[model samples]
Target: MALLAQQLRTPLSTINALAQGLIRRADRLSTHDVQVKAEKIWRASLRLDELIETILSYTRASAGGIMLNPGEFHLSELIKRVCREQGGQEPDRPFHLDVKDVPETIVGDPILLEQALVIVVSNAMKYSRPDQPIDVTARGEDGMVRITIKDRGIGIPERDLPFVLQPFFRGRNAKKLPGTGLGLSLAWYILKLHGGNLEVESREKRGTKVTLMVPETNTTGLSYSI
Candidate 1:
């Protein structure tokens, strides 16, 4: 929760500063400048919402209260949306998505699936250099859909790889970075709830790749109410 408070501070500050700036300088600013500032504020608000939702979901997941409302949805569209949104937040960075081999549709809870993808992609952006590209690729294999996110950033120490998905467990090299370390843990739980799994591979200072696999059909009947 302390890290959650820390993460919230950034977007909250952006929203407050931009709002106050617009209030004081709207009369002197150009219309285009005002529009740009408003967009930044909107994006910051969205970031704040995502951070809070992630924390709440993590809490619910830890309590075994999360559920899956599985249904059919376009997997490609979902991936595209995550890349687009994440790229928008960090315009300097690039998110390259490749889904030609993936099925057009898959059966699962789209909302939760999207959240998992968002978390992974956001992590890629956070650790990677702004100039580096984040690659997201999706494909179908052996009755499951595989989505992988790759980044050229500060990779995890081999010893830390096993605990990367554990809540509040940040890599020694990543300890100084700004993150709560709950995103991957929450994302892994979401995938498991949908009869899926998460995988990670990394090398210190090289790069990292995380893969998420979910069955093409919701046969597990995993559902809960909270």
Candidate 2:
């Protein structure tokens, strides 16, 4: 978790500047710069929010105190929202969202699901080359909803695949990365709570593909209204 906190270092600096301005001269912030700075503050705060969400996922899962507020929503829309949130983080990069035969609405804890998807998507981006494209796609079949996050980046070794879901366990290839390896673990815990599963496939020199599988809602199996 301390390693994850490192991601917020840059944002925290901007936040400090904003706070100092507001503290010393609230009146002189003016309308234009105030709005711009406010937006900066908002973005920085969101980074903190992501950190809190990721940490709570681990703490909540470990305590067996995980909970959900189930609701109905379009899965593709939720995917789009997660991509959009992350898109801001890497404004220069693009994520190809290929959704097909997706249900219009499904029942589940959207917040938790979104967090899980964000983890998968962010990892796909982080582990891959910035110049490469990350793919996000979804489809419903049989009794399940399957979402795939594919990246054409450095792949995980077969030996490491078995341990990737273990808390704080990063593959040899991932050791150079900054994460403490909590993302996949938290994602697995969330999916397990929802009767879902997270799976991965990769090669050393090739790329990797992660699939998130969950059972379809009783009322909407493989059927989409829009």
lDDT of each: 0.87, 0.79
RMSD of each: 2.7, 6.1
Error of 1 at 147 (Å): 0.9
- Using alpha carbons, what is the TM-score of model 1? 0.87
Can you give the lDDT of residue 205 in candidate 2? 64
Tens digit of lDDT per residue, candidate 2, span 94-203? 78888767777878778878989989988888788777888888998876789999989988998888888888788898787656578888887777666778998998
Residue pairs of candidate 2 with colliding backbone atoms? none
Residues 98-210 of candidate 1: C-alpha lDDT, one tens digit per residue: 89998878888999999999899988988988899999999899999999999999999998998998888899999877678888988888888887889999999889999
User: lDDT at 200 for candidate 1?
Assistant: 97
The TM-scores, one per candidate, come to: 0.87, 0.77
Candidate 1, residue 167: how far the Cα is off, in Å? 1.0
Model 1 worst lDDT run, 10 consecutive residues: 217-226
